[model samples]
Target: MKRICFLYCMIFVFLLMPNIVGATQSRDDGLSQFMFGISYNELLDTGDIRSHKAEFLAGEEIQGVFEEYDTLLYDKKNGYMELHLDASPCDCPGKITAAAYAKRNGGYLFLRNKETTCIYRHVNGIVASEPITSYMPVGFGLQMFLPEHFSLPKNDEAAFFLTAEIPRQGTTTTLQLKQIPFGLYVPSTTLLIDDAPLALADKAKEVEQINDPQLSLENGSFYKTYHNIHESALIFFDPEQFNDEAYPTELPKKELQDMLLSGNLSAIGEKDRHILEKLGAYASSYPPITLEHMSERFRFFYMVYQVEQNLVWDTCTMEWDSVAGRFRITKKWLSRKKPASFLEFLRDADFWVAAC
Candidate 1:
């Protein structure tokens, strides 16, 4: 019985040894190791060109960390590997030539600048190169590649890094690295205004007005009218239209004459009128009507009070024509305004600034 028990124990240990060894090997191999690249296409192209000076980095830990990937290939030559960097000007145009390199050993990579000879190591696929002292007519940048065998460092994490160096009248170089989580996806949704579905007609009209090819005087009549109304609280006056003494007077007397001819103005219903009136009243209170002074407009200005942050202030302006029973609201009218309670609008503007 003792002899039989000993033999069974030996068999059990043998069966478990391979799995234990495999686990240890995996830990040593640094699973999910990260690698970064500037652009994949450039790296692949570098590989096709067979440029020895260039290199490529590959590992599993790199994903969303690098913003772009370079296209390059690796070929083994006499117990070592050589990278080929080639440039095709038609597709990609930019300064700075970049490449990534890695050896079979897990140690980090160090790059030496030919001129300055300053050395830097690759940190999570980001390597900062020394400044360019030599004068080159063209630009230079880095191109990096990521290997497929590498996996994400985490389930859904991403990171990015950017660097740029431009010499006076010499070559300009830029490098960026990005890593993202594995198997990530995002869904699209319909855009809404004032908690209501945006009308396709209005959207189409906006697109047409923005992209109209003709640059004639009539083409921008409505836009010009809107700007004048916002700045002076009046229609296109004599002094605003043109400086020509022969045609000093305003050209169009009717409210919709020039706008209708320009295909920018259209008929509106009572509901639209009510909305415009409310928006106009809100916009008239703000000052500094310059284009850069406007704030981000909200569909429901009142709802801003409910947000946790007090950054909901906005301005809304509209131009009303009592004679024609028509009005127009300019995009600038839907901007945010500073509140008097926040120390003369200074504090309020600071609150609304988005985080970098």
Candidate 2:
């Protein structure tokens, strides 16, 4: 009888352990290295060549000007990956590297890598964000992103540890983000699985909802009881801090800002031009514009937003620009799903075009 009672208690204790364990997971300080990684199954699982996938957005387009540079390629053998996005008019250099390690489960692998992340400073202090290209490293200095050296595991099924040292700003070791209520932001994870072919996992559920609209650490965070994300409440950058207008004196006089909002692409600094061309392949879906024709309706462009599966999602609300001098268009990301004014469109883009 005692054995039976003890067995019942043991089973009941086991059932409650998951919730107890999950509650104790360590949270993060407001400032920690931000990273994303994809596992190479060929190196870890079966000996098969699989094509890993990733997406990027180059945020600059000048009239008739195209810059070229190397785009990040996902290597399946050693699992090295890189992503670069620069909108800086200054000649700045930045680089990030990535690699993969074996997960204990054996069926899956955990990615370990770090890259540059952003935060906003409004009024008194710094507000954490998922790093936007609103500010670029000015002048010339090496932006060293490699934390530490790592070696690939020779045995596909073996577990190993490698040393890495990623740097972060500020005095505090804790990772914090603005706009998000405390305790929601947790450590992030990303994985690319191998099925019949390689496939990307659903991030929200798989990675603890770091990308969830409600969990956003943006300046203007929004919450929703329904399934829909509140587009109006989101804010990408503080307008006062990150100016949206083009300063004539700051730009070169080689070409008219017209025909293109940024003038000739060649007019931009050499480093910027090179980065533009590197990310040029992604320009098709959201191409830069030259100038506004009378026949054309919208001023700037935006990548259409969708809830999932790349389906078109948006509603349109007209907004008029009164200052209207020379109408020039650049490849801007405009979401069509929720009809909103120019102000609201920007707010929505702030979250959509974000990094971990």
Candidate 3:
């Protein structure tokens, strides 16, 4: 009986050893990296790659190289696996080296330069020929990495690539290819806005303000001020600062102003519309008010109120830009979902309202 028990213990130890070693190896491997499809388009098509900066850590260095562009071959290499890109120059000098690594779990690229690193995931396809013409001016730089993990697409075959046109005099020996795994996806988690009913008086007052004409000027000062005030309100109400007492029946004017100015009001709920309506009315009734006044004011207020009530979630914020006359909402959690306007927000409200 003693011999049988000892054999069972040995078997269990043998089975567990591989798992322990694998976990340790994975940790040491670092985080994954890739060039997203969007980044490629922006860098190659629009020539705006420089605007998207990358962050680099100390003791890390990145260099660029030039190479012949071939779309079919590029697609073949990247289509099977998920790819992401960090940064690229608009043009390369000669024999541009497309720097990249195998996408793995919990892997990242670190650079010796202390620069910001912007990552892009590979979507599909590559340029068959270099985008820049010979002798034409081209920008070239390397994206350095910080010691952090980044999310990679799930498919294993995809690879992220970045190219830079290096002058004939450029150096290639500095380029390094490292392999790392994709990291866990972390959502932009936030507190849910409390849903409570709005006050009657506040609602009536906003309706009244909506009828004011002077404030609605297409390009008038009041219109601008009204838009600015509502814009400020969104900033003030940050969901992160919510405590039990933060939402009360009566909010002071100064408190509301503070919230608006702070640009933290990303999570105000519809049940809280009554308070917002009252606030809008109060703003409209200020000195130099006119009939056209409340139109733009009311429009902007309602837009924000609707956004807070209907679109905003724990992981995102919805807002309208009066200057551009468009609604914009962002959900970092739903990476695939594109940024939407007010109408788009309503049309796709169901997609983002889920609890993940």
Candidate 4:
């Protein structure tokens, strides 16, 4: 009878021990409890997977721009949260490399890292880690610059597997987000076209009356030529600062600028032409006079469509006339196709021509 009484007391003590120690075991696998904050378009997620999976435009927090030198850039927002994982004190501060991958085929995308203040560990049914009290906020933030040219089509959804790997600890945790759509922006408007497509005749008529080359260039500017020339020159001078891969042919600075600015494909060789084509496919810094007032519409151009990689002949060119101290469209090309405004000729060439 005394032995039976002692066994009952021990069972009662075991149940009360959990309450005495400030720990709770909601689940056997602690890693499975992670939650992510996914921001789509302008909508913010409250660190809930169900909230993230809801229908919404993704990637408003990330923006892509074609820089002056034609190198693509993606500026991403920091402060994405990974919440509810166990963290414990350890001898070494473990580092985590988090990356986004294509969920369908498991293709690797981009990864970034942050050091963990404490190691996360789970043994049996209990999480051997620091308890996140009600006073403390759960989870940590992650931020990384994805590949410069990485793009996903507008409205086309794909699954993104976000994984955090702690190499030192030999542990990896993954959470999958489905139906993630990416936003795209192109440097040159002509990239919207295929096969040296000609601009529509009717849209060409809109700017036929504007004859001043300076005003004409601004009215229907091709990609930002002046900035492109300036940036290319800078890249050639300071390769460390800017990507030198932009200019593959390796010409002298003045020559490279002149070759790009000239718009005379006959003057430059095949490789130089390839460089020109690549630079021309991105959006220009200056929007056409038509789109200058329509800021929202201009933004739409960047958020839709993939860029084509060919140069159409009707594309405009601008050269600084030192004597006049202003930019002028060269006579050789425009004169050959007289009366066709450079802007109008390139106008319908845009893929968004119908929508615009």
Candidate 5:
């Protein structure tokens, strides 16, 4: 009787083991889904290519806010700035409405809502023209033009303040984000946002645990310059039409390099040519910057291109050029792996920037 009971117990334990193991794994997978980069295709298509996975979550009161790039491209030339608020990734309880403001005198009542407009427009990448609202799969993006005759704020100040309101059941939750980069309106007070959400104490703890470097880089000088260069590159090479055969022939390789050095953007096609022309004209104001005279901080931007475009061999020996007073490429071997994109090339060269 004892032997028979032991056998039965063993069978029961074996039957339940798979269920226990599978349940834990399923929960882990679900948690990872909310982590980051799961929406890369969506973000990339919409030109929100910031890959750093810093996430800001709010408790049950509001769905989470995910920023692809901590920074928005500041288009000094066009006088209009755009932001993509991705609420699609979050689970919403109700409708979410937002407004922009300029912080002044410890309150957010300076800039009136009438000065801003939420319009659906995209220069390139994913076609997300829909204004951001609750429970949408595609997410929301808006462009706000600077008030007429207002100049850009002095270096690295908050352009304006953004406030998000979430109405759940009978209660309404108001969330504010601070210290955003350059925008049209200027506030008397700096708009540095406190990372900790005062509403949800528990969720704010989770946000505090994220130690992403991109958080700091968002406001750094290198990042700002990198964004300008990277976005300008996209304008010149519009990734959507990049694979098109006729596109490459439209601009010669030398001309493309010159464009970068001179900070000029040439319109490649009829699509959004006007914007391209504006960008081109604006970029032309900067004097020519050559690799030889490029700053050490920005040298990686040029080196990545050299390794991909100018390198003849997969491997090369650097020899000191006495006359040039710099390292010169001597021998070359075939690269073991070829990168499909500029970001991939940067990684392959082992000179990766956090933003990339």
Candidate 6:
């Protein structure tokens, strides 16, 4: 089964053929900083290439509260900067347009996740353009940047670079990027969320505890559910799209239970980091992650509130251990046996800042 999945992943890569990959990729011993690149199919005849120009303004403001994308930044100002391509004339589909590179050692380190995760449309302040319909899958080598070849790290150096292929120099869309600070508008002081309905243990107890999952795919099974979140106030989890059964009920952990009962989301992240990681990357062959059945083989399960994507998932895994006779939670692995979650894979301090 794993062999088949491996072949499938290879085929998937072959199909995309990635005009180029590696710049955005990290070595098993290295890390990947977010890089953006723009590319255009080069002209067939000319060894000569045209030049395009655009400018990015730093510190632009945006208003709508979007997830993941809400946090934005510039390369240089935050100790991160784009790699200078020198704009040499070139002709090829593989040619790069523009890219963002981490400029400082602090910038390149995965623990420092200083790369941009999403772009926002500036309307007074960063606002949501639209919910992303697609995501850049892992193990695909951060699709946009081109690989950089050089000796070991520099004395005054950041190790990674990002590159993009720009269209013929005169194209209408000139490349302009800005590094901005991310500010979350949670109405922190003025408001509080009502997680009360969700923490009702009595109601949860009334619901049957299942030994099986609600859905099982080649990747894994649906493990848990997001409780008390409304179909309306959320960008994801529209009731119209999913039915009650698709969202599995979880016996809220002590941390979440307290938050639900108290209306405070503070420090809730401190205790359940493991569960959160599982929720983010648990395998699912299905798109948009819909699970449909259950089984005892799918015992260990949990859910996480994904602030990055403003989405949520219930991670289900068959892997578990009993330490000294009590259930011991261990990190889950994907079908390929790669570390299953992004948070698990990266384990960077910056990610904790952005994600937590």
- Residue 58 displacement in candidate 6 (angstroms): 10
lDDT of candidate 1 over 1-356, digit per residue (tens): 99999999999999999996665422112211211232333433433332333332332221121123333222212111111212322232222222222233322121211111111111122222222211111221111122234221221111122232212121222222221110111111211111111222223343243233221124333333233323322212223432334222233333322332233333533443333333333335432222111111111111222221232212222232223222232322213333443122222211110111
Candidates in order have lDDT scores of: 0.25, 0.24, 0.28, 0.28, 0.30, 0.22
Pairwise TM-score winner, candidates 1 and 5: 5
Estimate the TM-score for candidate 5: 0.20
What overall lDDT, based on C-alpha atoms, would model 1 receive against the true structure? 0.25
Q: Which residue runs of candidate 5 sit more than 4 Å off their true CA positions?
A: 1-219, 239-306, 309-335, 340-356
Point to the candidate with the largest TM-score.
5
- Report the lDDT tens digits of candidate 5 across residue range 173-206: 2322222221111222222221212111112232
Clashes of each: 55, 29, 80, 7, 8, 34
How high is each candidate's TM-score? Answer: 0.18, 0.18, 0.17, 0.17, 0.20, 0.16
> What's the best-to-worst order under TM-score?
5, 1, 2, 3, 4, 6
lDDT of 6 at 141: 19
lDDT of 4 at 73: 14
RMSD of 3: 22.4
lDDT per residue as tens, model 2, 1-356:
99999999999999999997656421111111222222222212212111211211121211111123323333333333343424312232233433332223221122222222331110111112212121112220111111123222121110111112212211111111112111222232111011111001213342233343333333322111110221211211123322324222233322322213323344555443432222222224332222221001111222111111122211112111223211121222323245344445444332222222
Instruction: Locate the minimum summed-lDDT window of 10 residues in model 1.
Output: 114-123
Writing each residue's lDDT as its tens digit, candidate 6 over 26-118 gives: 221121122322222221111221211111123222112112222222222222222222222221111111222222322222111111222
Measured over all alpha carbons after superposition, the RMSD of each candidate to the real structure, in angstroms, is 22.2, 24.8, 22.4, 25.2, 24.8, 24.1
Top lDDT prediction, candidate number: 5
* Deviating ranges (above 4 Å) for candidate 6: 1-33, 37-72, 80-107, 110-298, 302-356
| Candidate 6 least-lDDT 10 residues | 121-130
Evaluation by lDDT, superior candidate among 1 and 5: 5
For 11-129, candidate 3 gives per-residue lDDT tens digits of 99999999976664221122111322233333233222232224111212322211223111122222211112233332211121232222233322211111112121111112211
